[model samples]
Target: MYKYDNFDQTIVNERVEQFRGQTQRFLSGELSEEEYRPLRLMNGLYIQRHAPMLRVAIPYGLLSSKQMRMLAQIAREYDKNYAHFSTRQNLQYNWPDLERVPDILADLASVEMHAVQTSGNCIRNTTSDQFAGIAPDEIEDPRPYCEIIRQWSTFHPEFSYLPRKFKIAVSGATHDRAAVRVHDIGLYLVKNGQGETGFEVIVGGGLGRTPYIGPTIRSFLEKKDLLSYLEAILRVYNRYGRRDNIYKARIKILVNELGKEEFTKQVEEEWQHIKNSVLILDQKEIDRVKAYFTEPDYDQNAGDDTGFESALNENSAFTSWASRNLADHKVAGYKAVVVSLKAPGIAPGDATDAQMDFIADIADEYSHGEIVVTHDQNLVLPHVKQADLFTLWNKLSEQGLATPNIGLLTDMICCPGLDFCSLANAGSIPIAKQINEKFDDLDYLHDIGDIKIKMSGCMNACGHHHVGHIGILGVNKKGEEYYQLTLGGSAENDAALGDRLGPAFAKAEVANVIESLIQVYINNRDEDERFLDTYRRIGMEPFKEKVYENN
Candidate 1:
């Protein structure tokens, strides 16, 4: 983790004082609702349906144990005794007092954290693969560059108020765990044929009312030009992107209207001049940033843990959780542990205050003193000793954090729908709960393997419904909530939009509809194929009919 220098600390302290003044003005009626709207948004405060919501940024999905404890304290004192982790790897407090938000910001600033750029028209959080450094498939760690972008974009006056909100994601791994393809700007850290490192820049990818998997704007961009190239892209979008209609404001809409060829040409023309400018990152600075992320001291020669294998064989529960929750770590004798947040009956990604402290303790005790928030609404201990798997599992299970349902049908990504969001037409958390209860069998869920079911309250695609293997969108019909289903969507490499599966279903009928689709998949799947693989191979005709025939 990059500790904030004196300059960074000063920046946050200044913002807290600034936000305090703005908040005072708004409350005292000196700032009208129209005037206060953007100000509050910039501070990551939203007046939701029931109460004010505060979104705190967890930069590139990395947070220290100390920071986690701070969040737990915030949740305990400021809002309800829990916080919602967003799909973008940020945390949301649903019921914070608007008057006290500045205090929250000040508290966050104390721990080198804040809500800056977590919302607003400027650049949002710069996310990356949660398994960035530790993933065996990674070419290099993406965090150094993510941190660079985080620093560059933090207070850039030029991009603070874009046509609409902008998002960026970087993936260093061979597989796209970060869902880079659907961000406004997606950077794939890659090595060229000559072994030179750079980015494969993909632009105009987003999911909202109009969904798009961004086209490759640049085949290869050198590492030195990362910030400059990004500036060029933002400048192009900021110059020409539509500001007339909120619905048509995202860069994806602009890219689609202009076409990729023309967009690429414009970006190239802009990049030509700026590529060699001062914005170009110096190798020494890049190395300095990279130095902060070096691996924890490990037992280098601790090759194979026989005890870990023995634990797996002896305990069925431990083995089950390990199979689903544990992923291969880059280092030997270590594993990346996925703490599933999609526990049954609870809102997905809502970690209670006690749970946060517990998870923080687990990270300190079992893994390194750090945690990574996964895009799939899970917490990850990126470096856990293999021998400690059982102990970690037992501790997590006791706290209702160890579901062992990673990538299963029940492990769904859902937005804080009508329950919290004013924009949501229908409730998403309830739909997730309904679907989760319907598909509660672990064995059955595992059999219907590698399924991603995402639910969104509206077309904003906050839940990333457009990229799930099974996408569910909530719609309001005659003031009643209905759920619409989309099939074959994926956020992985070769990202594609999901196909809609006919008419929407009532809230009560949602669980049955999902079951019908699951049954269809099981009946039609080929040998060893995942839900997505089967969907691509077999197409949507079978699943579509199964879902709609009885409706």
Candidate 2:
């Protein structure tokens, strides 16, 4: 994890003082609710249905043990004793008093964290692949670039107040774990023909009321011109993106209104002027940022211990966890382990103070003192040695953090729906719990195979329902809560927006509807095909026909 320098420290300190004063003014009634809204929002505070929610930015989803401890402390001291981790890998506290926001920001700054750009219509947190360093297929570490963008976008004068919020995701691997396709600006780090590293840039991709899989504006952007080219794209959108209506204000709307060819031409014209400027990265800056993310020291001689294998054989629970939670690392003696937050009936990403303390202990004792917050709403100890896997698994299992259902149907991605969110139409967490409890068998999940079941309480798409293999969007029909289903959506290398499957189902029927859809897939799929591949082979027609056949 990158340590904050004097400049970083200074900026955050000043912002905390400023927000403290702002909170004072708001509570004293000098600033009206309307006036205090944007100020608090800029600092990542939202007035929710019941209470104020404060979102703290976890830059690129990287956290040190110290930072994790700070989060646990905040949960205990400021608001509730639990915090909800968001889909963007940020953490949210739901019960903070409006007057105490500055105190909260001060506490966060103590740990070198803040709530900046977490809300309001500005460039939000820059996301990257959660498995960036350890993933076997990565082209390069994407966090350095994400950090660079964070520095550039933070309080950017011109682009600070855009028509709508802007999102950017960078993926170092060919596999798109970061859901880059659904971002306003998606950058894929690619190697050119000569083996030189560059980027494949996409623009106008977003998920909301109008979901769009961004178009490729630049197939190969040189490493030096990364920032310059991005500036050009943002400049184009800032100048022409719709502002009259909130719904039509995203860059995706602009890209749709103007065809890809014209949009590309406009960006190209803008880039020609700025490509060679100071924004172009040189080796020194790249090295400076890369140094922060250099691989941690490991003991190479720490060979795999048969103890872990024995534990797996002896304990069916451990065996199940190893199957789902553990991932192969590029290094011989190390494995990447995902600490699931989506337990059977808990909030999807809510981690309690004790849970945070337990995981922090595991990170330090077992896998060095580093932790990763995966975009899939899970925590990761990215460099655990194979010899210590069993010990770590035993500890995690003790804490109820050892659900081994990664990428399976039960390992769902869900937003903090109506349970906490004011924007939600129905409850997403309970629905996720219902589905998780319905499909608790790991072998059954593995047999069903590689399905992303994303649910959102509303169309805000916080859970990214638009890109789930089986997407569920909650809707309200005459005050009755219902869910709309979409199929064939994906967030990988071949990203595509899901198509809706007929009418919405009442809250009671959601799990059964999903079960019926999966049954249809099992009956129709060819030999050993994944859910995505099967869906692509035999479009939504078959699943749709079977799901709504009774109607």
Top candidate on lDDT is 1
Could you tell me how far off, in angstroms, the CA of residue 300 lies in candidate 1 after the best superposition? 2.1
Q: What is the alpha-carbon lDDT for the whole of candidate 2?
A: 0.88
Model 1 error, position 500 (Å): 0.9
* Clash count, predicted structure 1: 0
Q: Write the per-residue lDDT of candidate 2 for residues 1-551, one digit (tens) a residue.
A: 67789989889989999888988887888999898888788889998999999999999898888889888988898877899888898999999887778888888899889999899888999998888888998899999999989988888887877888999999998788898988999999999899999899999898889999998888899888888888898888888889999999999999999999998999999999988888888878889989998888977775655676677789887787888888877787788899999888887888998899888888888777888888878998888988788878878888999887787898889998888889999989889988987887778887897889898999889999999989999988898889999988988888888988999999988888888888988998898898888888988888888878888
* 1-551 per-residue lDDT for model 1 (tens digits): 88899988999999999999998998899999999999889878999999999999999999999999999999999988999998999999999999899999999999999999888899999999989899999998999999999999998999998999999999999999999999999999888999998999999999999999999998899989999999999999999999999999999999999999999999999999998889989999999999999888887765567888999999988888998999999889999999999999999999999999999998998777999999888999988989788888888999999998999988899999999999999999999889888988888887888889999999888999999899999999999999889998999897999998888898999999889888888888887788898889988899877777865
lDDT for each candidate structure: 0.92, 0.88
TM-score for every candidate vs. truth?
Answer: 0.99, 0.97
After superposing candidate 2, which stretches have Cα over 4 Å from the reference?
A: none
